[model samples]
Each structure stands twice: as C-alpha cells, then as structure tokens.
Target: MAASAGPVLSREEVDRALARLGAERDAVESALLSLQDHPGLRLLDGADLTGRTQERWAVVGQGLPMLWALFDRYSEALASARAVRARKPRPGGPELAELSELLTGDAVTVPGGAPDGPQRLGAPARLVERVSLDGLMDRMNAWYATVLEVVSAADAVWTALPARIDLLIAELRRVQTLAASLGVRVGGHPLGDDLDALDADLGGLRTEVRSDPLALWRPARVPAQRGTVPDGGALATPSGVVDTERFDLAGRALDGVRLELENLLRLRDDAEERLQGVGDLLQRADATLAEARRARGEVLAKIAATEVPAVPGPASALRERIVVALELRQSGQWYRLAPLLDALEDAAAKELARARQSLTEVTQPLAVRAELRGRLDAYKAMAARLRVAEDPEVVERYEKARWLLWSAPCDLRAAAGAVARFQQALRPAPGGPDDGAATGPADLVDAVDAVDAADGTQQGGAWAGGEPADGQAVDGRVQGGRG
Candidate 1:
C-alpha cells in the first residue's frame, strides 16, 4: 500500500503518470486474456476436480470475473481522464490536479459486500473498496499467480499419469497371459495375489486420474510473502506439484510382475535341463549294474576269493518318479513338477554312484589275482631272457610260484610271496663276485649262485630262499647251497 504523503504532481508530471497507467492497463488486459485462454485453465474448467484443488479452485474461480470487472472500471476511469485532457491541447492546472487525485487517491469503486457473505473471493456480493492503480494491479497479479499455479499442477498430473497407467496395464495383460500358461493362478501363487492387487489399484488409480486429477496433487507449500492484502492478510505462495506416492506404487507393482515373469521363464529352462540330467543318470545306473553282473561271473571263474559282492539292480522307483514329473511338465503343472524333478535327479545320481561302487567292489579280488598272474609270467620271461630259468633255485621258486598262481583256489598271498622270491633269485647282487658283465643270462645265473652260497651272510637275507621267521625255507625246501 502506498503512503499518501508525497509532493504534488505538476501538469507535466500528471501527464506522464497517466501515460504509465495507460501502459499498465494494456498489460493487465493482455495478461487477463492470456489467463482466460490458457490450456491449463481450460483443462481445469472441464476437469471434475477434487480434494485441496477443488477447495482452492472454487475461491480462485470466483475471483476471475472480478478481475475483468476491475479491469473495465480501470479502463473507464482512464478514458475519462484522457477525454478531459483532450478538451484542450494541454490541460489547465485544475484539470492536472484532478487527474493526479484520480491516479493516486482512492478513485476506483469496488461494490459493497452482502451482510452475511463469506470473506475473501468466496463472497458472492462485490466487496466495496477504493484502491490506487498500482494497488489494484498488485492484487490482480497475486490472484493470477495463485490460480495459474493450481491449474498447471492439475494439468501436469492429467498429462503424465494416465498415459503411463495405460502402458503398465498393457504390460500387465501380457504377464497375466503368461501366468495362465504357467499354471500360476490366483489361489495357487503369491505372484497371482500381487498381480490381482496391482490390477485393482491401477484400475482405481486410472479412473481417479481421469475424473479427479487434482485430488492426486500434493502441494509442497503455500508460499507466503508474495503480497499483502489492504486488510493486512498475507498472500500465500502457490501450490506446487502432483503427489509422487501413487505413481511410485504403480511403478513398483509393474516391476514386481516383471521380475516374477522372468523367474518363471528361468524355472522352465531349469526344469527341462534337470529332466534330461535325470534320464542320463538313470541310464548310467543301468549300464553300471549290467557291467557289475558280468564282472561277478568273471570273479567267480578267475578269483579264488569266496563271497564276491552281488550287483544291485537299477532303481525302478526313481525312474517311475521321473515319468510322473515329465507328465506334470507336459500338463503345465510347473509348480508341482519342479520340486519333484529335483528330487528325482538327485536320487538317480545317488543310485548311479552306488552301482558304480558295487561294480568296483565285486571285481576288485579278480583284478588282484590277475595282477599276481601277470607278475609271475613277467618274472618267468625275465628269467628266460637272463637264461637263469633253468637254474635249480630259480626253477624251483618259479615252479612253486606258478603252482600257487595258476592253480584253482589260489592263495594269492603265498603266490605273491613265491613270485617275489623268484624275482630276488634273478637280481644280481649289488656288489657280488658276478657284478661284472651281468647283462647276459649266464652271468646273472652265476650271480644268483654266488648270492645263494653266501645265504643271508653276504646279502642280509636278501636272496637264496632266505629262512622264514621259524628258520625254515618258506617253500619247505632246503636252502640250495651253490653246486
């Protein structure tokens, strides 16, 4: 509000002030027309507004007509001043003084309020007030800003929310179809429950958005100190924005649906791979069991050891479970089938492992006896190559070892010891009399003879059928003294 104490305007000064007021009038008219034509304002007019926007807009809407009425009055007063000045090329002192009073003083009349009307813009009757040109412009500007703020905020929500909601709804439909294929129904899965909730929330939100967009807006604050009323009331700041909470909730729900869909796809791939793995495991078990049965026959014929382990049959129960799981997958019972497949695969692998272990156990004694026979034959061939196969001690050890190794019900322990003795009879002494030129079989035979003559004296019981712990030859023959 301007103070009334200032120097009086001369004729020229009054003329200049009138020109400035005229410019201000032009600007105000243009601004008002712009506000009336604004797209946001148009949308607000058509929208079924609710909540805080509805309350604020009602007050703001009442004031809009008053803005134009005040502007018309301002134009009329300016036109009167201009006509009086035009009566002469330049106005006289009295005319200038009157114009100054009109520009500076309370010359504009706002109509009187009803006796029991609501205060502020809500009042139906025009409130009587007299304000200067500058004061009226300030009030108009403040009201303009307040109304524009609310209109723009609501328009923004309408523009942003509805289109986004539609897109999410489209995506939700696709997911629902996929969920149906996977047998993910509302009562069966938590994903279905979440989807149902999201559908309801989104449907309601879209309807609310289309109908009452302003209801979704959350203003940051009504800013204070824009301007003060003549009645000393502070003009509050404009409301800012649409609430983000609903938008955020909708986005999160869509994300949850997307994540679950991806999980279902991964489960589908895993289920197929595991099914194949189970089949391979069961097949391997059958092969291992067959091999074990064959090895049992071989062990009975070759190995003298009694009580060979029996081969286990393939696990038919686990195979049957795999068939059930496959049927479930084919029928699209994925949730029920997934765990069953896992259990089947694990059982099949264990069964295969058990069969392999049984086969190894059943064949092990035969394997040992075969190894002993191989060692006996290899030693005899080595003795023949050395030409010590006919040496009396070498021949005797070889014959006794052969009898134990080649005979039925062979004592593998005795056969192995006899073979070891023959091997010892063939090796030349480390530094004996025939240590020289020993590669030929005759020198090797003589080396054995020399080691036998020493007889636990020269070689520390290493050769010559060394006495057992009971001090007799192990084969129950005399230690052959060198001929």
Candidate 2:
C-alpha cells in the first residue's frame, strides 16, 4: 500500500505527537515481557536437533538479543533481567563431561565410517552457533530502529514547544473576546470567568516562558486546563488580527452569520412574490364570478322565451320527475319500457348536456367565443337534416319524437317507441312498392282529388240555383247534374 500523507502538525501539535509516542513505547515494552515468559521457549530439549529444529532454536536465540536491547532502552528492570538470562546455561545437565574433553581430549564417532571411536565437532557446530547469533542480532536491530523513532519524535516536540504554546495562547484569547461580544458566559466552568480568566492564564504562561524558556519543555508544567479556557488571550486582539488561527476562526463564525442573513432575505423576497400571485388569483376569481352572474341572467331569458307550455308548477318539480324516470331506466328495472325509455333518455341527455354547455360557454371569457360558435354550427347542421327529409311523414314523426324527448313530464318511452315505429314504416320494401306507399303518397293524392271533386259539385249546384229552369225530369233524377 502507498504511504498516506501524515497530519500537518503545528509546533503545538508536535508536543501532542511526542506524548502519544511515549504511550506506545510502554505498550511495546509490555508485549516484549509477554514474549520472554512464553512457556514453549523454556521447555526446549536437546535430543535429535535436526536442521529444522536447529532453525527454530536459532530463531529463539536471535530474538533474545533484540529483546535485550528493547528492554535496555525502555525499562531498567527488564534490562537487568535480560542480562541474567543471557549468562544462564540451557535447562539440563551438560552434554559433555567437561568442556576441555569435548574440545580436545575426545574424538567423536563419525557417522557411516568404520571404527573411528568419535569425530571432532567442527564446522556444523560453528554454523549452528552462527545461525542462532544472527537471529539474535536481527531482533536487536529492529528494536534499535523503533527506539530511535520514538526519541526523534520526542526531541522534535520538545524543540518546538515554546512556539506551540504561543500559538495556543493566542487562539484562546481570540475566542474569549468573541464569546464576550456575543454575550456568552461559560457559567460555573472550572476555567474561571469566561474570556477574562482565559486571557489571564495565557498572559501568565507567556510571562513564565520569558523568564524560564525551559518552562515550556515540561509537559506537566503546562496548564492541563488550557483547552477549557474560554477565549484565552487571543480573542482580545483588534478587528484585523493577523494570526492565522484567530483569523480562520473569525472567518468561520462570520460565514455562518452571512448564510443566515442571505436565507432570511431570500425568504422575504419569496413571500412578496407569493403575495403578488395571490392578488392576481383573487382578481381572476372576481372577474369569473361577474361573468357567471351575467350568463345566469341570459339563461333565464332563454328559458322564458321557449314557447312550450310548462308541465306543472315550478320547472324544478318537472325536472325532478324526469330525474326519477331516468334513474329507474338506468337501474335496469324497467325491462319492458327500457328500450323506448333509453332512446328518450339519450335525447333528453343530449339536450340537457347542450343546455349546460351553452351556459358554460356564456360564462367563459369572450376569447372562447369561437369555440361556442363552432358548437352552435354543429347543432344547426344536425337539425337541418331532419328539416329537409324527402317524406313529410318522416319529417313529422321526427318532429314529434324530438318534442316528446325535450318536453317536461312527457311519456318519453312511448314517444321514442312511436318514433321508432314511424322510422320502420318509412323504410321502402324491396321490389314490393316503389310508389312511396310507406308515406301514403297515393292515398294522400286520392284524398286531395276527392276534396276537389266535392268542391266542384257544390259550385255547380250553386250555379244551377241561379240558372233558368229545366222542365223535363226523368225517374226523379236531375236532368243536368254537375257531372
């Protein structure tokens, strides 16, 4: 993994760094002691020490020296323990009777060789010792590196302590002044009376440092309550303080105020805009109400002009009866009369819908007059077809049907049935009668002829009454009839 960038530590932050390193060193020391007392290492036996066994023993031996170094650096008591352990022998009787006999007087038996009593321990023994010693040296090197790092961090913190104290003092003072201006009181706080107490504390620190520069080096001498000081001495500076920490804090506080002010201003503007919209809506509503009143008057005039007789009482009473009949038809209860009623209902519905639409159009803005005109034109077009029917009977039947449909309290179903019958009778039968018999055209013509003949006879009799007398009469019949 790539190394992450470390925190940007000011001089004051460095002292905090040193304090953390000291704590870590103590934890490391504790870990080393635990390793030393591990039961497996203490139980090591010397029988059949193969290459793999040798490697394991070498690791323990190598680790011992580094452990010694770590103990030496971090704990005086542990260092003394390590020294005693180094001087001690393995936990068993000696493998050779005497050190001199094993080295010079005795010859060891050589493996896979004939009757040489014993061979001298030489290169293999030396190699085993070297491996163990190397492991011990590696561990020591690691401990040395760790101790150096801790010392470096501590020294750096000590060197920068004075400047860090100055910065912290300055920041505290600035915070104090602002808190006072805002009327904020840290009541009952152990850091004394708000910003004032903090300022005194910072001043005292600065005076202590000037007199004895080493005062800042000691962590215990520095006030533990420094963070609790409300404003310290930094906040008491003038409006344009050049210190970075104070300036940054003030900017943040002012930025929050600026945001709040902007939000309130935006809210006020939005409220004004909404108020204007409401006024426009009210004006439109008033205009619509006025138009509705005028249209209502026009509808009353139209109703009054209708020549059809009122069925009975108020128009509302008649309307109620129609509504009841419609409801019955719609409920599917009027099975026998349903077809005829349905036709009448359709016509009534169309007429009512048209009336309502007309009322709506009258109330609508004048800009919509074109739409109203188009609807009227469509209605007139529909009526024109009925007016110009070729058969007069058909035309009469249609007119009667329409009248029944629109008339209040009329027997709408019966009227629709009659109209349907008329329509059926008007249809010409194929190749049966092409003489317009359905319309009774021939009968109508004959009736007209008979009426004409009767009128002539009457005229002739009146003429005879005023004429000269015809004397001859035969069998009681007039001699000169109109024929």
Error of 2 at 37 (Å): 41
Whole-model alpha-carbon lDDT for candidate 1: 0.68
Expressed as tens digits, the lDDT of each residue in 1-483 for candidate 2 is 112133233333433433443344454555455444533333232223334334334333344444455334334422332343334343112222222122222112112211111121111322112111112223333433332222222233334444656665666655554444333345622222534554565565444433333222323321111111012111111111112343244335444533433443343334334333433443444444454456545434432222221111112433454555445434432322233334444544444444444435443322122222232233233334323254576567556655654444333233434444333333334444444333454443343334335433232232112221343211122221111
- Candidate 2 worst ten-residue window by lDDT: 233-242
Best by lDDT: 1
C-alpha TM-scores of all predictions? 0.75, 0.23
lDDT of 1 by residue, 1-483 (tens): 233324557778878877887887877777677778867778777877666667877776655576687778788878877877777777777676667667776666655541121224455454577766666667666655556566667678887887888888988888888888788879888778878888898898887886677677666655221332333232233556767687687778778777776767677878888888889888888988898898888767765645777787778788788889889888877767766876886798799889888887776666556655665676677667666677799899888988887787665556656766876878765555542334555567565555445332233331223333433322222121111
Model 1 residue runs over 4 Å out of place are 1-5, 84-88, 111-126, 215-249, 262-277, 304-313, 370-423, 435-483
Candidate 1 collision pairs = 223-237, 386-441
lDDT per model vs. reference:
0.68, 0.35
Question: Cα deviation of 192 in candidate 2 (Å)?
Answer: 28
- The stretch of ten residues in a row with the least summed lDDT in candidate 1 is 474-483
